[model samples]
Target chain A: MLVGTASVEALAASAPTISAWREQAVELRGVTCLQVTAEMRRAAREAVLPPALHPTIPAAISIQAWRVRDGDLGAFDFVCCRVSCRSGVRARGFTTGACASTERASSGLAGIFGFPTRTATIDFRQGYDGADLRVEVKGKTILALGATSPEPMGPDDVQYTSTLNLAHTPNGLRLVQVEAHHLASKIDRLTAHLDSFDGEAFGDARLRPYHVVSASIASEDISLPGVRFVCRPDELAFTGTEPVSRA
Target chain B: MKFGIFFELSTPRPFSRENEWRVYHNALEQCRLADELGFDHVWAVEHHFLEEYSHSSSPEVFLSAVAAQTRRIRLGHGAVVCVPEMNHPIRVAERAAALDIISGGRLELGTARSSTWTELGGFGVNPDDTKITWEEFVRVLPQMWMSEEFEWRGKSFSMPARNVLPKPLQDPHPPLWVTVTSPGTELDAARRGLGCLGVSAAGYEEQERRTKEYHRVIQQCEPVGGVVNDQVHTMNFLYCHEDYRVARDIGVPMVTAFNVANAHLYWTREAFPTRAYQTLGNAGAAMKAKSRPADDPSAAKGLPEGVGVGDPEHLIATIKRWESIGVTGINFLLNAMEMVPQEQVLESLRLFAREVMPKFRDPGDRSRVYAPTTVPGFVSDPTC
Candidate 1:
């Protein structure tokens, strides 16, 4: 992790030792965000983590993008994002496999937490500050880090939240449904975003309803008028100073 | 096709007294510039308690100021709310007549039934009854303008036989128009022979369907004004630069801000639960919002595939699409939410005039600058 963390069990004798750990809080308008961390004090207790995975810090992060378009998934129209942070810290966009793979999910520690739940709720306000707005994604869903290659899920391959809704069919099939908010339009913009399995070890057993979410605000110059920049992820750092501004 | 400018007079947060004045005067300056740029007309909305969405509550006064500053560009109420509760029909007639006279008959009288709960409730206008009231108001308005001593006993207002003084300079009245936001309103505008002043930022497909419906229906309808002003004037955003990317970069945020602010005023049964706005904001406008990406942080924000917010070539192609759809004119919302600076707005207008206007503007012979003197070829002697 970017910043070191004390062991939970080591704090007191009453608690048992655990190698893997994760924590997050995502209420954007309330100025809160998800912070994930995984600590390993002893190799014996940290067996849950995938092999060859290590923690990374979110030292500097850049504003990647925030949008909610119509999608085929049942949880369509929720705000979601791919927040790229320094030192290889990628936020949520995990699939059922990543959430189950505690080792790989916690491998990239120290990132943001977000709620990509079934419910489509977004309360966003912009221009309260000179160039800043507030976003709130209340409610709950699962959080995890997904690695495109089993190479310890870096920041770029991870996602902050998921907004695609997965429906449990009568035949026990969890099929992706059209987005809830803009149902008529989302059907056209749907893509199979969950195909980034990367030969992981877990079956699709951890598929809770999938939901996507994103928080976007436009400012008039002083407030991030957000001129469109086709700058690649690397170029973002050159074009803009990676501000630690959360929420 | 013709072009014009429309305003909601939106300003940014931390709105001070200074910003309000600046918004008004900047609009006047823009109107003056629009006249200089040969834009056909300039229109402003009449709204109340709309916070930052629209501040132009008194269109007559605003148009008066605009008229005094500009010489050629026509001024319109883009429209005036015609509910009797908000404005007595007689008063609307008088005010419109006065403004028309002041502007030397260069007035387009656009009328509307209140569309937002904030305004309908503020004026205590009944949504279900507003349509009837507006129909009565609009029908009677023309009579009030044309009749020597008008007398009317209607559901909304009853006036004794008294002259509606200061009759409009136009033979019958300024060309009539109505805000066509709801689905059937365009047909209603056609049936009444009024121009469709569409508030919805409809897409090309929708506009084409509606325009076709209007043109076909209006041909078989009776006239509402002195003569049929069968036209379609739709709303759109305008931002032009040599570079298409540069134009969108500036236009997108402004367009998004305008849409968001507009949505706030649109009453949904869930948010407001009011009959006004038909328990929903303009259906077409809402669909327009739905058609657009809810949040597009990228610079490609403002106009879509066929919108008047890009390079001259892009705008020309976009306008041709609208023209092919049978749209007669486009009213460009030059600035909103203070997203684009005043200087940027001026530059955009100038660029559009230079690059886009000439393609569509007819180079026909000029009409008379002034009507002939009362006694043709008569010379007045200084000695007399």
Candidate 2:
């Protein structure tokens, strides 16, 4: 998992209060940072989505599999990948890392709900309040999880929060906003696939599936250079030191 | 002074709920108007996945629609990216021939290897291999067009040649044009004995130099296709109105948009590291925003100095400059980036036909303008 964080206050400042913030959130929903480390181990490796819908979806369904040995990482890995759809049309290649965010969000939602569930459209707006990160996911509410003891608390504490704000607009069920914080450890697992598959695939490759082995919410304040986020006095603060923010 | 109106089928502001359909119908109307006005050609570009800059990804379908409506105006592809990933050689030859037959021999094939990374990487084409693939496709196209049964085994593309159907009406084949943006490619086009379609945005001096080089190379050429070539055509931006300032005000934005969009789609992809070509979505806007005055007459800005905004008189002056530079045909870009209302474009065409075309269409002027040169030995048909 590749864990990264961006300042929510900064994002909010950059985005407009009404339309821009909501649009930015939706745009952020497409962010991906995960990488795959295993190839097709099962024959019934159906593409995650229907073929007709592949053109519009964030993740590509078709992929070529390859094997690689990562001496630096000290692991053997298998990967499935395809050229980005946008790049394929332009006849060029450049792998974008942010696509994994969508995959992680999809998988997390799928785990909480069930398979073959209709994807609820969600838009996330990110902003920074001082050093604290603020993220809002707006859309149709499907599944909402409340925080349990020992489980980390998200902003609204429906721990697995899925809120769909349909009543806000007359056109239809458009996402409005749901605020949250970036729990670094939880995000680390959400984004783990990004690192595991990097060295395993050559050239442009599709992201690998997420394998959530373990996840924990840090309760202590963590400090890193060039980063400042305020945690509740008793609550844990998760800090990311990487210069680049994948989400 | 032959006229060809350009259509990229762009959709500007107020993208209606049914914007796509409106744009398509609008383009067809423009083609019909151009045909009615006796424009010599109607050229449509082939661009994929570019939202507003270009919506006509399927030029074959669009051209066929135009072919059904227009009578005299030649139907042309500003380019069909000859790289195999975008289209196989056999497919290209077959489609071109079909369109030719459908258009009653009014088809002109303009071949190119696309410049943008968005197209190259999107189709999983290796940039290094595109040139080879294009060369192979171009070489095979003539065979597909001329032979009853064609078979070829090439390093990049291979096929057991079968009878390709709907042979073109133009004797051996249709007139061949290779679209070129650079001087090197112009020379290459000349060496292959193919007609040079100098599609660059360079000023008249640079175009003159490139056209001179093309003529020089054609003089000592070895044909790459099945037949030799005789003429070179250059594309220029032309919007004519009674009011020169109105032409500049309205037409300049569209022309500038098209040039910047084309360049951005082509150049910025090279800067990034990737396996598939993707558009630098912001690059076009950034380029347009950073635009500066073309004070330098000799800069390689890809546009002729006197282009963009002009009246018929101004257009005549520009054509005179191009004529002095030895361009055989002047392909005026009439409706660029879908700017200029259809009525306005038709008005511009009608005005040019009345004011500028008459002087160039005179027999005396034609004879003085088109220089006679000996046909190359390999020409299958010297009539063109």
Candidate 3:
């Protein structure tokens, strides 16, 4: 019954464009991901989400930083900001903005998967006791997060929602459903502290992270499969879901 | 096996006082029919801030209204959320006692720690502490009912010595039960010598496993009340019609509507990551993928086993499967989203009572008496 009220044009202003849907899956191995989630203020509950998705109660945001040791685009780090939401009953995240450590990685990701990515200085480190992430744009720190007191848990204990990336495709301007498969060898839950975040640099000024809910670090293999579906940005997913591929 | 009706009191969109009034009155009408048709009990859920999914936040009031309307049908004051913020243990005890007195001792007390962040987070309750808080409430409620002056120095709440007033009409207390939503919670019920009120939609295999574990552990339990309630009451849907297609046509959408509304609630695991909360709870377990194809040969036989839809014959086979696996009783949800017309709902209850219920009980068997003396009762007519 509750639908997001944000204008699709405003949301599409900063979204990356995808020329075509990739038919092949992209694989990255030995990736260390540090994900920090925090509840956002209620004011941004529907202001940041497109109508196709439903904003979660007491809106929340997740900031994830990944260090890819070996991948198709070579060694690089990536940081992305996502607003938590639901895409027709399934939990999904709307990617607000992202930055890649290298130009090659940024261009590759943007072209293949519509990752709203730009090159930035990203330092993501994970040790036994703690994990830390710092994202810098033009020598100005945009986001910094620290997670401590690591408690080991099984990899299956963690759940990852699919990402909805707004992008221009062959069909039209649509929200691409990009699902990823993760096979993790290690996972840890941590107490997190948000040191700083520049919401404007994250593509929206209302994207500020409020109270921290949880943080986790995992060592895993990440696979991004080809896009299978897209939905109209201004309509509900129940009525807007359009399949992009037969498979 | 005992049969009861469960009410979530789901009111669909355009949630107005008018809409809520209609839902309430319609549910009351159904309760009246269930009572007249020899149903054992009527269980009302306690939920808050969950729009459309459940508007029965004040179930004690709702159950009291039912108490005033009907006799013989037991009142299940289910699952007064045993959280300090949502409900103080003292208030829960006092209210249950009052409801028991009002219902003439025909009351079943059900306790639970809520499973939704929509509720726990709304009340500012820390999800990690809910288990311990629920533990304390279950232990102290019986003591409050039995003691003349009760004092508590518990981890979640504390109070000076005070007589929790308005003792229940039952001799010691009402039958104590804990709602089992997440896995392993039935063990908590068993260890506390409480009844297992399963609210989730687990299939026969998983339920049989849980039932086995519950029966085994309850044999050595340290009960939280004067008597241990070993009953296992599983929740189900009811949409009986003589025509099988009619039942499927109407019943599947009601189930889907309830599941979707239930999924809208923000689950505790999604918001707060902790061992205390594991699964998404409720709709997560209930919303299963379509396992059988439409063209499957078994499609003509009517709905699958354990689904309480279809013709009376299908429901009989389904309930027999449940009984085969040791389910003591079942609580049926008659309607959701008001999908079934009021007249049809009343008809479904009447039809099920006439066709399916008799097969389970003897000719002279009547509704179980709630309490020996204080409870004013009803003698069910076999001809009805």
Candidate 4:
């Protein structure tokens, strides 16, 4: 009588699945999944704003990460990210437009520009090339253009832009490789990105630690080369010397 | 005024697929009949992985099926092994609550920390930690019942705040009981404020003394788990026939065989090095020794001391003595190890109900005659 009449299928379907990209791969040593997510959200909110923006933007984010310690090769970590602008405007009369975008990027440069290029699409495109890189903002600039003006201005006329990046880390990227091997199929998209491009528009954008990403390795192969990544989903710590900044 | 039958669905000695199903269906049929016959309760034992002695591993499943069929007879778990290793406390609470709703609150939760080595070792349970785990379970069960979002960080198990659903139909909870086979356990049950289910097959004098001790300890009991105080119930074997000699000839051996089989299964743990004491070799030898035909008449003498195996008149007399000794109710062990035919056991139950039960039907007349005046110093109250 202690066992309920509820079917296993009903229970399985109703339980929540991992949601939120910012929270995808952060790990906590001795904590429940819920606690880990909460901690990740706190850190995302405290993250420094891009230098070009005049004022700090208040934002919220979440992530979901999973690692396979054993069994068939698959995603080591999958994450989703979201951000909302609290304040800032281009002009007094222009209507504010909110845009959302989703992208799948690799944790490794080999994965990012190797065989297949990971694509992130936006609403507008304005080419801005740095010293050796051509960076394109696909959507309307954060600042609104005056309706009466004949030409549009850039950063001088804008407040801030809303952008979200969803990518796999080295550990997470490894998992994708293992999963490709496990499924017995070649990875056409990521492989093409890795083989075709070098330091083109992103000029060793691959060199940027933030730009560098990795996939999760199969849990069974936790000891494989460059695949033994143990990052707490709850704890956010910066590693490399370069600080995070906007282009 | 509750009357019920305990089923292990035991199929000892002559094992047959037909006989096994026969015993099982008979118990289900008995529950239906007991409901029709106006019996107040029908209980089953929960055991795991034991072969012939017990096949009723999942009592909840069996009882749920029983619930579907019976309308009036309350279904009871004589004792649920409340160790975390075997079952989680939350699972136990949730399951019990669901059963109560299914059975219209006719579920009685009788719990205990298991004593046998076979059950303990097979599940990797530590003997010394049994009491602690049981106490923790008892402590947490009530919170699970009362709170919408229950959370606890105990020594053994911990969980975050979450509402545990499908609470029991009974207000507060079902009547909780604990099984006790020894004198110390009887007193312990009283101090914990749980119902004492005395299962030892002891003489009338010993039963009287233990019952008295239970009442004495219960008077000052500050409840440990949920309830404020405890209730007490005793167990006895029952078999009735038209002729005293006929009943003695058939029923005595069956009861004797059950006792020997149980003792051998559990007591042999003292000899083995392994945590699991169940050795098929030892159990088989014990059964063989017990079933051996006596060469001399003196070897197969009078009823094995404590067993109640006789005609209607004798059974009634035995029950009266138990009542006089201050025991609340007697759980009759009707069909044990399939020693007797299903039909014969049913006949015994019917005859006993017709001839013996009516005598003790009055609620006012059944109250304990001697109330204990004070609590003994050795009996410490259980702390939740």
Candidate 5:
């Protein structure tokens, strides 16, 4: 669980003009599965009717279990949304349910309604020119009535880490429990299976089920940064480079 | 990997109403040829009120016509805008069901939330609400198709319990897909167990990563439809030729023109000044101003780097790379900005089928394979 009070900063003075990427680290409060499932609609209803002094809504919300880039990290996606607080203090970070990858983020988010805490923060680093992006979530007093649907692993989902919850508490809202389930995914299997292709599975393997598809590399004259041209024997020379989000 | 063709139905500058007719007829002719030449799918995009960039607003009508003309090729909605403001849920289901029945169930329904401010605002769709509306629209769309009589009361709409007619020929309805342009949408698509229709002209490196990520995540994705269509289609440019240089010369200009024309669209950021446009404009190539390159055709002789736009060898190599990366399908943007003459586009399709398709054929087609020494007006690899 990636939670707790947190502050983190990373700067690389590669070049004052530009650093291929800048020191783009900031703290962000996550918009929980609860907020997405409830608050938006409730905000709409409150607009239509009277504003509830204590807005309570029951929701059986199924969170799109966000997969991490690695163990306890952000998603493979690198998108960011900059949020500004009432104090005019602004922080920018990836707009992903990344913090949901942990029991800590769930508990901290749950703390907002449960304990009525002033603010809770956490530290996480994205591999953005190797810099840390920190986020601080200010607790909201709006009471919600709903239990988060337990995070269930998909048909072939592989669970490497933890889970987050959105449980309604008499105190407010708290994450009931976060646990790791059993379901090894094809993604995890890819990492394990990529190097084992011994060229024995070429022609027959083309029709094989549960395999990744790719186009052969071209561009003889022009060199691409991380592309390998497929040789005649049809063997792969993979770069093992991770894809970065333009986010 | 499957090979498919895409159409935006662009009518280039220096034309009037006659060009629109020419564009549609030319596309129909192209589709006929693709159907005969053994292409997999003919995916048409849905765009509204955009001049030159895309003239295809009514995909069902166009696809219905294509369906009547062809027999084998799969009919796909590159995406039908899922925002209720743009298209009512029942209408999409009815039309898709009708098309599926008409086309003998060769329908792949791809859905999306309107991105451009032009389409969204034009149809009175709130930019902020489009995502939620899209989610609701997809969730209930299947219910409408599957249930003989369906009723829905949600944030988006309220439809009384009534029989939605014309059940699809495909059991339970057509395969559902989501048009993904924004980064990280693949995961959402997987979570809902929908196909990832990558509309962007993302390079192979990016496509490879996306495909890998998709296959990885989709295994555990919860299905939004009746069943998961665990497929990924990478959109690309296709202008195949006998000569590598000729293919490069013809295809690159079309790509650049298409990109430039597409970028000129009135995004939400431009009009509303806040909302989707700001984030997407910075992230997409839409904001990049483009100009017509000088008349030196050699200057335009190179294909879009990391795209399938060169000669047979280049395309073969590129398709092979994408196949190796685990892309289940390759969606080729056949005509862009109307730069390529219709005759040339048809010839390019024929040439691609002749030279490139054979390389990826199943084991049964080994007898038809083109040998290395048969240059066939193309440059043979010196390395070979």
Candidate 6:
């Protein structure tokens, strides 16, 4: 069995604490999500994930930028980068880092959902022809994703896997399972081009995109539910997974 | 219904030379026994880099060995992964032809574009091109087998005109099949007039729906092969015992072992986000949903529906359900991860043959529609 070899301490470095986790579920309407997936350099694949997860073959990464038109935290844009991995048999994404357009959006993401977030300028746009995302931190451009040739597809065509967020919990440092439900109204396949990326800013300097795989944009109602499960970062999920304690 | 044994040649952990040797020898023994018991076919899958789950990477080689041992049983070189990186069209035709000649024209050719990123990425196969490449492979293979000299200028590869040597013993070419793991692939099979070799575990309703759609679509088929192999052969597990509890006691572990091992592979959709791969295509999705801990004794009371497990009666009923859904054949995976001992697997085959198989076998079976029709390179009246 292939397991990740990254140290728990290293993975938790960019993870928020459970102190920010809330039990309330937040639902955002009319969210336009543009996701670009790219295969990462295979040499540093194992170093990007904790031991509880298994790195995908030809290790890959997904960069998702979402534009929220209306939400409890008001309208804001954010971009999240995740390493594709597996927790036991199910597909999961290991979040490396996230950047929100506004401080309010960053705090809401960090305090409510335990996202490892910081305030940054995010330009996320979707039009009839294509979708594009640009992320800038401290007046320096960090990432840019451009997708073209929008081919309409069914809503069920795109699958969003649950995410594993490595965070310091009340109990200990655990990989929290953050599952968001999406009801997509429309979806389009796109030809993706990754113009620039700074892997260092995305929590790991070694996390470089080797090849662009695919891109898609979806109009969806995104819901962030309360945390349900967490697993020990150093052990396999079969033995280490436990239910989240309400207390 | 036609009953066949499928081999993954799943060797246990501590994957030593001795363990691999034991797996091969045991599989040969099982094949010999299956032939003696009047089993119809022996299908071997082609997989790569899938440790413990499937070690039979070179299925043509394995099927040739089985041919040397068995006399009457047909050899199914099931699903040579139809990727340009993994298999060139000419090479696939050459190997299948040789295997067919070795088996005295009893070879059934099955093709597929693999689902796992483990195999595809290992071979450096781009996920987007697999479907197109598979289409090109299937379209060219028959031409290679039938023509004195064949050439192709295609998207995946271009070959100069040359006689693909060692033409198959079967008149035009062997029956063609395509392994259906993804949901819409049955339509691909139907449209191409190839057999639907279902390698995944789908429920009765889903299977019925797919069967209906397949039959509906094949009516307008533009065949990719010499003859339209209008058959639906589902893959399942087989473990029979007089006592249902005992069957569950020994059998559930093997199934669990196989499911876990199958799930271990990184699927295409998980790694490469694309419309090409929508779901994790395998038995892992369907079977894993209802799986309990194999050692959970409390879980061994009733028969799992549609599985070839439990007593002979239960096996009969399960086979009947499949038959009712227009499945022409079933290929059984006898052991996985070598979870069942060699002796026990043999015993299970013997018990199933004696008490369960006879109940379904009929001299006038309608599934004989799948038999070699006198009209070569064409489909007979499928309405029978």
Every model's TM-score: 0.58, 0.57, 0.85, 0.53, 0.56, 0.82
lDDT of 2: 0.48
Give the alpha carbon lDDT tens digit for every residue of B205-310 in model 2. Answer: 5677888888888888777666566576776666777877677678777676665445324332332222222334333323333333566331232333546447
What interface RMSD does every candidate have? 18.7, 15.9, 2.2, 35.0, 19.7, 3.1
Give the range where candidate 5 chain A is weakest over 10 consecutive residues by summed lDDT: A83-92
Best by DockQ: 3
Q: DockQ scores for all the models shown?
A: 0.02, 0.03, 0.37, 0.01, 0.01, 0.28
Residue runs of model 2 more than 4 Å from their true location after superposition: A1-247, B13-17, B266-304, B363-384
**Could you give candidate 3's per-residue lDDT for residues B1-384 as a string of tens digits?**
889999999988778999999999999988888888889889999998787888999999999899999988999999789899999899998999999998889899899999887788778898879999999888888788888777888899988888888999987789989999888999999998899998976777778999999999998887767777888989989999999889999987787677667766777777666678878776555754234456633267657446788998888887998898889889999889898999999999999999999999876665666332121232211111
| lDDT for position B162 in model 2 | 79
TM-score-sorted candidate list, best first: 3, 6, 1, 2, 5, 4
What's every prediction's RMSD, in angstroms? Answer: 18.6, 15.8, 6.1, 25.4, 21.2, 5.2
Residue by residue across A63-106, what tens digits does model 3's lDDT show? 88889999888889999998888887777888888999999899
How accurate locally is residue A5 in candidate 4, as Cα lDDT from 0 to 100? Answer: 22
* Tens-digit lDDT string for candidate 2 (A1-247): 0001222232222211121111122112112112111222111121211111112111221221111112111211111232222211121211111111134433322222111112223222111210111111243232111111232223221121111111112221121222222222322111111122331222222234332111112222111121111111111111211121222
Error of 5 at B305 (Å): 2.5
Worst 10 residues of 2 chain B by lDDT: B268-277
lDDT tens string, model 1, A1-247? 1111222222122111122112222111212122221211222111211111111111111111122221111111222221111211111111112221122212221111112122223332222221221222243232222211111211221222211111121212111111111111110111111211111122122112121111112211111111111111112112321322222
lDDT of 3 at B142: 78
* lDDT at position B333, candidate 5: 87
Question: Which DockQ-derived CAPRI band holds candidate 6?
Answer: acceptable
Q: Quick one: ranking by DockQ, best first?
A: 3, 6, 2, 1, 5, 4
Whole-structure CA lDDT of model 6: 0.83
**TM-score between candidate 5 and the true structure:** 0.56
